[model samples]
Target: MISMFDSDVVSAELLADIVSVSKATLLKWEKSGRLIPSQNSITHRKEYKVSQLIQFEEVRNMINSNWDQELNVKPAKDFSSVELFAGAGGLALGLEKAGFNAVALNELDEDACKTLQGNHSQWNVIQGDVKNVDFAKFIDVDLVSGGFPCQAFSYAGEKLGFEDTRGTLFFEFSRAVKEIRPKVFLGENVRGLLNHDNGKTLSVIKSIISDLGYTLIEPKVLKALFYRVPQKRERLFFVGIRNDLVKFAKFQWPSPYYRILVLKDALKAGELYATDVPKSEGQSYPNRKREILSYIPQGGYWRDLPDDLQREYMQGSYFLSGGKTGMARRLSWDEPSLTLTCSPAQKQTERCHPEETRPLTIREYARIQTFPDEWHFSGSVSSQYKQIGNAVPVNLAYAVGRSIIALLNSIDAEVDLGSDSLAFNGSFHSRQLTLLNT
Candidate 1:
């Protein structure tokens, strides 16, 4: 048997560099059974043993070399998109960057709906429950997109179908996909969806998409921080292509940006924007809370405070294990903001300004998510933050949009190559099924 700890233990940072993956990705892999790290019994800190590293040739190769390259390219063509659950338009705006025109957007929240319409008057903003809408009405669309909420399916039999999933938001999303039958569709959701109900939810989702006559790509969880957005947000993205088109194309995930964007870049006039984040309505901590937080330095948290202050601030949570890094946290200008919760002022996930003693304003939240400055959010300041927090980062969406366009372009190429001839034959349906299965 091979020794699991033949060499010295390596820190996660070094291991990430050695493996050519982000620290977060390495951690997620550990959690997902892809990798296992040895733990120091006394300190309870994780470390990758050198013996374990030697087991993976890929990591050993990266550890022995150092090289970085960047790619620059433009979209081949301008594609069109119809988005559902368009919160604060983060994904919508990103798709726009990939050269996709937003033809229609649908969201149930009155404020988010208003936000979408207010910013882009040309867009058809439909505000209501998705169940009430008829997506088939929109024809000739190139892409259909949504960050649809994931809900458990009522499994009546071994396999789930379109009708069996009724009453769930995913059903509406699938309904739209079935009705519109666009060239491609993109679905985004929280990473938890993968393990929800012990992964049954995702399994059913895959089944339904397959049954609906689309080719489901291997679902992937994309981290926003890796894609240039400064936040540590992760979302599961599902890509589906029309059955007839899958065999004709290959799709690649977007490459990560060379440098990470940090809090300063978001709020200050820098690479992310031309000017500092515009002053706008922001939530403030109470006088007592503000005084307590004043003691924390930029990037510091409750642990930096005196014992008395830490006790008072953390209260019951102080006794709990695991780093509650969010408590009394003063965000560092050099790092990405922790995932923004719907409520910025929430005690568990406080996203305070680096210099100031206040919650990030609605505009700052939008900016962090990469929503263009010109984009306007509607409803109360609180509602606006909720919409922004719940959204997919715009840049991530753009990257995914580019991938969709590439897939579509590949399909077009195949058509030109005589791979998809328009001949009415008994084999057409079977060929479509075969393409989808691939």
Candidate 2:
């Protein structure tokens, strides 16, 4: 096995993709001498040795974790959650493990709804758009959660109101929370949402959330890597408390896992898994893509291609300044995976397996997201990928769920002294409660 310390060279496009930065930013870094670019003799294109990234504090921490300690925290109270945009139940399943019984799960995609229903027939999987659902049915649910799509709003008026965001899915999320009036609400979105539109969009979201009678805690972008998932995906989380409950609503975000998980831990029988990843249907690359990817090494991308092939594969993008690292990329077993996109073998964001030259299989994809082996996905292979790729990593959601449960437990005991609460080990706790099992 090649050590992660082995000097890695990648194109500007790949580095940009890795850090979610722009090529213009790379140039800015270069100008500031924060980044030094090297030329690939063949393409004469600039590449950067990954030595700087390797020595980076965060990267170093990722590669050198014990990852040996396992934490499966349980809930402090038997809370119920109503999930919107519940894709294939990744977040739902993890939250269930943390002890939130899902009373209802609403999804727009039929395949994703079936995937949820197929796995857990008892779940009330409501199929169709968020706009159609009457969330009033789930009244007084402990929590309402969803990974709503982000949309830009018109700032035509001086202030953005809850109604101003009417056309966007986020508006639907806010609407559901308004109707259900849950004690707590969790909204998830892509990390880009944190800074979308010069921060105006997030500011508007915060304003709308506040206007809806909830106290919006400052949103945080949680990195999946820190939460025991073997991937580098980032999701922005917004936790809000019902206005009346804000004083006592102490919501602590979940703690990071003991160590970072890697692809090996995910796919093999190790810390994150009890058995090898099960074989299943998957997307395959065409002969040309397969042939092209064969030349790349584990953790390598298009820059690893031969000069002519680099030009051939990249074409016009070859001349483009960005590294486009997702193209013809293969993951390294020793490190956490780059985020999995909807289409694994798509031209711009391929997720080829480490040892094999094809895209990751369905089960492999699930494992990387920390889904249990017995959990079955129902849909065409492509639809399955869409479900899994778009999901919050199971382990990440579990960590968040645990924290939410802790907060709810505290409130239950404080507000109603007779309430039964869950102990750290899943048993009952006392009225004066300690939050996390920390």
Which lDDT values do the candidates have, in the order given? 0.78, 0.82
* Candidate 1 per-residue C-alpha lDDT over 1-438 given as tens digits, one digit per residue, 9 for 90 to 100: 122222366656445533457778987988887777888775455677665666565444333322122123344566678888988788888888777888888889999888888888888899898888988888758889999988888765126477888888888888888788788899999999999989888888888888988888999988776566877788999999887777787888776553456788788898889999998998889999999999998777889999999999889888989888788888877667878889888888888898889888988998899888888888888898898899899888877777777777777677655534535554775675565444
Q: Which residue pairs overlap in candidate 2's backbone?
A: 12-323, 13-322, 13-323, 13-324, 14-323, 14-325, 76-422
Best-performing candidate as measured by lDDT: 2
TM-score of each: 0.81, 0.81
| Off by more than 4 A, model 2 | 1-73, 156-160, 417-438
Error of 2 at 302 (Å): 0.7
Write the residue-wise lDDT of candidate 2 on 167-208 in tens digits: 889889989998989989988999999889988888888888
Q: Which regions of candidate 1 are displaced past 4 Å?
A: 1-78, 419-438
